[model samples]
Target: MRLTDMAPGMRLAKDVYDPNGNVLMRSGTVVTERLVKALRSWGIDEVTIEADAEDAASAMLDPKTAAEIRALLDQQFSLSNRDHPVIQALYGLCLERALGNR
Candidate 1:
């Protein structure tokens, strides 16, 4: 798939292959400019980008909805921490749940 084939908000994945068509990039490597160029040159614009398929397959969730869910979960689960990391994680969880990603 070429970059042109990619839709708005679509995630991307790349596979770096040697001359033998062997996979070079190990698992979990995110896309970068160099990688995109290489893939485009090869006429392969889209590879299987790793998304939280679990999340993507579920409903689409907005940030506002995610926040509301987070607040409710925090209250219900008794997650009292207000620190950045904790809050962020909780926020992410809430987003996932709201999005049906979890």
Candidate 2:
């Protein structure tokens, strides 16, 4: 998963390593915002993580379809406070629905 996808409470599925091959985190470490910040500082871009069923399903969403759905959602939510946490979460739920329907 990329840094953009990482979230607190997600569990690592494998060890994370630095460029020099130093282990950063062992498997099963619960992700935290601070840890994500540290990884960004270390220039780590991606790490494998255990996926829940919803995540697994979302991973199967086609890129083109997902983009299209997001575009549609953006238009639908154009008037809302997109920066608000509630708005962002609602957007996520809508995107999930849009993709899952296909």
Candidate 3:
């Protein structure tokens, strides 16, 4: 979540930590004007927030799309030994890129 998108009364989904590793704000902390200002002063730009199940699911690749991507990756990597560790890692990265995860 972008700090600019946050509004008063919005609750945090996860704990926020400072660069020093100290807890800045706990999960479920309600956003307030003062807190927003403080976060800005601390150079915080984004934060994780609780997402609905539908929203989370929408961000993930569906099984069919995943399988299609995997098959394509397999074909692309066919010239290399699929069983080789390095090739397998490359395949994983290719799949991630194909699925828009990276």
Candidate 4:
């Protein structure tokens, strides 16, 4: 969830950690206005929130969409050696950007 869209009383779906690896807020913590402000101050821009079964299902990529995304990624990286670590990382970034936009 976007930090700006989050409201008071929403429960976190995952734990939030600081730059130093300390847990800032545990999973299942109920959000508060103060906590939101603190998160913003701490440079947190987004977070996962608990969702219903339907929401979780809808969030997933269907097989067709997954295949399309995979094909597109493959075409984009066709000229690069898939075994190279840097190319692999770039492909992952491309995949994330494509999925996020969709």
Residue 29 accuracy (lDDT) in model 2: 91
Candidate 2 residue runs with Cα over 4 Å from true position: 53-102
RMSD of every prediction:
9.8, 12.0, 8.7, 6.6
In angstroms, the error of model 2 at 93 is 22
Best by lDDT: 2
Q: What lDDT, from 0 to 1, does candidate 4 have?
A: 0.74
lDDT of 4 by residue, 14-43 (tens): 899988998999999998999999999998
lDDT per residue as tens, model 1, 1-102: 234433344344435565678885655565566666666776563355444542453335665665576577777657556567666555554544455543
TM-score result, candidate 2 = 0.53
C-alpha TM-scores of all predictions? 0.34, 0.53, 0.50, 0.51
Please give, for residues 2-101, the per-residue lDDT of candidate 3 as tens digits: 6775667767777999999999999988888899899889988866555442134334668777677778777788799989967755665455456655
Query: Residue-wise lDDT of candidate 2 within 1-102, one digit each (tens)?
Result: 666766688888779999899999999998899999999999998776664633655767877776777788999999999999788667766765576579
Angstrom error at residue 53, model 2: 7.0
Report the CA-based lDDT of candidate 3 relative to the real structure.
0.69
Per-model clash counts, in order, read 2, 0, 0, 0
For candidate 4, give the lDDT of residue 39: 95
